[model samples]
Target: MLNMNRPNDVEAYIARAEADAVKIPGLENVRPRGIASAGVIGGGTMGRGIATALLCAEIPVTLIERDPATLERAIAEITSIIERNVTTRRMSADEAARAIKHLTTANEIEALEKSDLVIEAAYETMAVKQDIFSRLDRIARKGAILASNTSYLDVLEIASSTSRPQDVLGMHFFSPAHIMKLLEVVRTSATAPDALATAISVGLRIGKKPVVAGNAYGFIGNRMLAIRRHEAEAIILEGVTPDRVDQVVENFGFRMGPFRMGDLAGLDLGWTRDTSTGATVRERLCEAGRRGQKTGKGFFDYDDQRKPVVSPEAMDIIAGLAADKGIARREWSDDSILDRMVLPMIDEAAKILAEGIAARESDIDVVWLHGYNWPRHTGGPMHYARTLGLDTICARLKAMGRTPSDQLRKLLAAPQERQ
Candidate 1:
């Protein structure tokens, strides 16, 4: 059996990899035009956050919205954020005033014409993005870098709408874009080398820890996150309660477990009224109108103040789903639960490494450390896997009755390469 505990020398290894994680590839040759001005489309939370970061970096920004009402709301929300930061001494009053002065709001897409860099933080749908990029292609000046703040959509498809595909790339920012340190600078096959360099330059300017990822669904962080979430949902259907699953994960050093995160982000993220089958726990919860923290209930119910409490209603739903699937109900040990949740992510990372979707294993670690809040001391998933030993991880996967990917098999064959 594989040892479940981390090796004693894990910290020493972490120290070494952390130094290599932040280096951007092909940066020395990148002589991107200085981004003195920027434009942000769709003045929602993400747009506002991106705009704020630009303003704070002393780059003037043009924030565009659909109409007068939304433009007003976006401006108000942005001003309030700056005001609060000033009040808390996070930004000086003079600095806040200067940032506010640097901001410009517009109700027309044409306003972005003067921007040296244009980031479309509009809705996530492909059609909406396609329309925006198509228009930007015409409105944006020659040589201006066009970026999409898309989380999972194909950047290549989005780039196709525009004639200058080389100028296009994905600048994926996590939620609360201003505060989050992780930015995935996704490069498509057609992305210009200078464009990629420009993105790395701008991302660092805004105080973000940027990592380069290839053009793929979910890229590096989200692709592996999907794997973890799939297994987490599966084990739930096999008898684990949401709270118990969350507890084991939280005990592993994550601030919040999967279920709690789902609740906070809302169960309705991907749920649609047209797809109302109630097949999964999330779909059923949405069908029941438990839209999560916003609605006071989800996988866990909330008190009036919105603190999560284990809901008997949620347990009943889980039990019914388990029965429907013909899975026997049973208790799970913390160790078993932790392994099931984490090992799949590690396996997926190995596959990502083999596929060259990420530059280095440490880059994947940087994505998780800053993007997903993986425990920093563990040195991200790839480092954690190294501590477990590739051979040991391969054996554990087989013992868990899971099929290891070919990439995993190859890694096991040359385990010394991992070191």
Candidate 2:
């Protein structure tokens, strides 16, 4: 151990000196940049970008796609991304060319057999991921790490499908993985501590800030979005137009309003109920084919500049639907809407911490700041809550006639009960 003799406060100094030894289970032993060449399975937007990120780090990448046509498309997408990087001066022409050359494409799974690390960016389906991992388990070289770039689903379940659970972990990269800086590293119970350490180092090498998360459904960011969506539903049901909701929150700190975000991210993403929350207005919107921007309509219509304008038709629909459901309308008080959206987000943030899904409030905050475009000025969702006082946030929810989920309620009451 390094000397702990240099401080005024004995315990504090000793603890400071031991920081490197204080890592969680899978992260206790790790070194940066181990097994070089990375493998990216699935050539979709996320996969191609991940491959590019690895290449930018000077790590050769083997990007695998099942379809010959999609393989060609993935190559083109990688080329486009590299060109953008070149034009922006983030990379030079020669470096870009070298990176592209280092990127090898394959329609064959066995190509990944040579990679020291492989991230499966395949479809969201559990079975699909299971099939991919089953193949990787047999072919991946010994000691090679296998990771999943799953956005929400349980990483543990995906890791369980692989032969070596210890080397299988979640490497949740944000969309357009090369540009987004957050990479959530998830460790299952069976994950090897050293492997987790390795994953963090890998994240750093590829220019990402990896926040280690405990395994759970939806992990951190997307899981909390449930609370946001719920409040959006309540407000819309309370006679607020989708456009109004989007505008309010967008100004509140979000880069885009939730509904507009829904459109941009594709309403179909939330429409397909992996689990049912009962039929709601959102379902109706989906049925009507009013998926956000790509359809030229969602909560609002987009112009040539992609600047959204209030949709006459969506307003008409919102009013009609409210009337049909006997939901009343009112001139929305802006603070009320802000409280409704943010308080629950705060509550969920607290519960996520209470459940050990996140390592710290900073981890949760960084995820939002980097991946979700949550305002960096606010320091992240949890940090914003801490600054506001959890008790105050919880009370705000109560005053709005909102019933926070049980987890949040327990979280809020626990401290009071403890004190």
lDDT of each: 0.84, 0.77
Candidate 2: global Cα-lDDT? 0.77
Name the regions of candidate 2 deviating beyond 4 angstroms: 1-28, 270-278, 403-419
lDDT of 1: 0.84
Please list the Cα RMSD from the true structure of every candidate, rounded to 1 decimal place.
Answer: 3.0, 6.1
In lDDT terms, which candidate is top?
A: 1
What is the C-alpha RMSD, rounded to one decimal, of candidate 1? 3.0
Question: Against the hidden reference, what TM-scores do the models get?
Answer: 0.93, 0.87
- In model 1, which regions exceed 4 Å deviation? 1-25, 412-419
Candidate 1 residue pairs in backbone clash:
none
Kindly give the number of clashing pairs for every candidate: 0, 1
Q: Give the lowest summed-lDDT range of ten residues in model 1.
A: 1-10
- Residue pair clashes in candidate 2: 26-193
